[model samples]
Target chain A: MTERKLIVSRRKLLRVGALGAGGLMLSGCDSLNRSEGFRSLLEGAEDLHKGFQRLGGEGALAREFAPSDMSPVFRANGNREIADSAYRQMLAGGFADWALKVDGLVEKPLVLPLAALQSLPQRQQITRHDCVEGWSAIGKWQGPQLSRILDMAGLKPQARYIVFHCADRFGSTPYYESIDLIDAFHPQTILAWRMNDALLPERHGAPIRLRVERQLGYKHAKFVMRIEARDSLAGLHGGKGGYWEDSGDYAWHAGI
Target chain B: MSEAVTSDHFKGGDFVRRHRLSTRIWHWINAVAVLVMLMSGLMIFNAHPRLYWGEYGANSDPAWFEIGSNADGQGLVKIGDATIETTGVLGVWTDSEGVVKKRAFPGWATIPSNYSLADARLWHLAFAWVLGLGVVTYLFWSLLNGHLWRDIRMSRAELHPKHVWHDISEHARLRFPTGAAALKYNILQKLAYSGVLLVLLPVVVVTGLAMSPGMDAWMPWITQVFGGRQSARSVHFLCAFGLVAFFLVHIAMVVLAGPINEVRSMITGNYRLPKDREEG
Candidate 1:
């Protein structure tokens, strides 16, 4: 009889204990779910994100090279070149007629030919390309600094971002990417014209490609056809900027 | 009925049988995932071959102790024909000379740097995604169904120091009062589970992601949070330590609780409760 009573009392105590534990856990959940606190946390996280970008300043550009460090095998990732007839024809002609059209929010819209781009003072750099899928390769790249081109075209004061329009298309929509002015004028930022002392191959981005060296492989926009300076990206295709950005929700600032 | 008779065979009462199918699947999956993660994680850690923190980075000065070879020539032993060497600045060391040496710090075996970091990273990342998805889905399901707020949650009464002390004392004596007493998870289980889920997992994920150069742009705070990339790596290892500790305690508890019945319920999603022998 005494054992039965002890068990009954213990059972009641256990119930109370469980109830107490449940209450503590709820308080923790409440802290996490608080609207204002959560929002502030996100804002703080974004600020820290920007701070990192600033820390890797324009001076933090990838090292320039003398064509020696280029890998003997610069294995191409994904498609070598678009199978589209138009792109193929351009490639056949050695891309002499190709021009990089810079327009949108620039004071002086310019259609600079590939030859004209080469005439400008060029910078060469050896840098590592880190792929998002987790591989890294060091290669040599030579090109005009993007800052000089933007300056030549004369970006409008209102222009806050520069969008790279590429010849490569995922399907019906052509591939395009955008970056804020901070990245736009970064000294390391260049429109690479040559790789390993040779003209950029069709498999690579033939006439021109943007080498935002600080970012991942996807950010390296190849087959550049146009440059659009803009304040707002809301009007762009899918409003996310890049193909992967639209499809995979890739974070816009893919800096390492 | 047959079901009732079968239910009477297990200890812990009817509550033990109430685990849902989803819960059972997640439980076993987590078990397997954790084991794989731990083993692979250990193998990866072996590469760096040494552990340190704060101002004491892997190559930092004030040399704590170095692995591989040492001046004292201690902590060396032959396993099979291969002569393996060990040394210490602290703790104890047996040298290649068959002499035992003692010091303030211990030199550890340089993990055989055999595996490719890239491959190890691939395995770690892929398994991490599986672990992450499982956790996210489990948390979401539990929250939606109020399980988070109810089952594993602690009530105000349980928070009382006196109550906690009483439970601790009871646990020390191995006197688990059965029946309705077993209806809810004990306070110890609640604390351990909550710590593992809420704290350790997040720390592990954050430290791991922080080490990535790709996400460094959007999540630079990771570097700041963990001091630097190397520090983040250290923290990641520490968090792994905490997780392994929790896992050991968890397995031990399951064994003590009744390994066969616990394992069966987790696997088969059914448990027979223990009843009075007289009633049978």
Candidate 2:
């Protein structure tokens, strides 16, 4: 009788412990997630990841793939087509009049048209684009290195970050992204005008898109209309560096 | 199930030191950290509930494994050519608020319990450091203190099939070691523990680093080792489920071996041996 009673109670205790602890923990985590302090504490890990990533050296390049490795169907994600009339007009006009505005914290502010951008020394590389949504696609991208454009404009010493103002928008908010000077000067960083040997399609950020090869897809702002050199990311939209970072709580440094 | 097996009714042969302080500390910390990482990782998986191979794969690409819902709202898990219906558990389930959710994993099994990939990543990344650092620290300490060789290493004789089969049969019959014999781990325990410490933990960490694009820049060959980033992701997922399988068996063994006593031994580092009896 004593043994049976002990067995029954132990079984009950185990059951209760498993169910109760699991339930309490799940609900407790949800509540803790809502707390600003707790969320910030968790976000603190971003700094550690960033610091460790920088230890790889600034000039280190992301692995590039062969042309044969390119995906047959490279999926276009986010803002496939800008609904704004100004952007639609430019698209309809074949982006002939479209000019990339280069200004802010620069000695010379210049507007380069599509032809001028194409005329610059071009580079083509096949690279894998990793998305934050857990997908990757390889494609050949052709464009001049971003460093060449920055050199053409002559960046000021105070300029610490390069911000890309895009034509796409989510509701009333315009899409934008920023990168540090190290990434800005990266050899692979380019304003890709062509993909997979064809003129860039509208669904895939036609005419031009910022391709920061080392980072996730969201950091590669599409429909890039203006490139501004800024000393800081603050005072920008939502005070975050990119659209997803601002609205979706994505980390501004999306190298991970 | 015997009354004497209860922690409170400890009429055992002797109370012996079964686990060291370092082992106990590492075990408890990992108990929380590993679960957090797994749950949050499931939430992250919910974002794209598909696994593939090679350096590149997206929506249009063929996936080797995927948890998805058809047009009829039936939840299905597909692995290669085989498909399993997993309604109400995965692919499709109702949340705590009584609303239907179309996610890969149930809310109860995920951190934050809602569809927030950002929040899930936060939880996953934060606990990753804890789990990663804990493995490193525990391994270093075990090496320094000779716990790795003294407690976990199996002798050449123990590695023999006959000795292993004997231990397995003993475990199958629930014939647990008694008296002084209970102080040391059998061959099975050593294998499981060593597998977790050396193989599973290290592979999981390395595969995780392989998925990071920034880390890819630092060590491009990491991804290449697994064929590609997506392959690394698949390996990471498999290893996580492998750990889960180990956890389930470990818990069942704890219950069968006397939960109160086993848990107390883990927590307090002291275990009371079962009294040995002569068979008639």
How much RMSD separates candidate 2 from the native structure?
A: 4.4
* Candidate 1 residue-wise lDDT, A23-133, digit = tens: 543343234324465434433433344464565443454433334533445656644688888778878897776788999999899999888989999988776565554
Candidate 2: stretches off by over 4 Å: A1-20, B1-12, B277-280
Tens digits of per-residue lDDT for model 2 on B247-277? Answer: 9989988988878778767767667677765
Q: Interface root-mean-square deviation for each candidate?
A: 13.0, 1.9
Candidate 1 DockQ category? incorrect
Q: Report, for all candidates in order, the number of backbone clashes.
A: 34, 0
* Model 1 agreement with the true structure over B1-280: per-residue lDDT tens digits: 1123223344534635556666777786776556545544654553444443321133221212223444554543322345455444323454445555443222121111122333333335446666767777887887897666766788889978898899889878765545434545678878888888778877887776665554543455765577654466667777887998998887777667666555556656555454433444
lDDT of each: 0.64, 0.88
Q: Report lDDT (Cα) of residue A137, candidate 2.
A: 94
Chain B TM-score (model 2 vs. true structure): 0.92
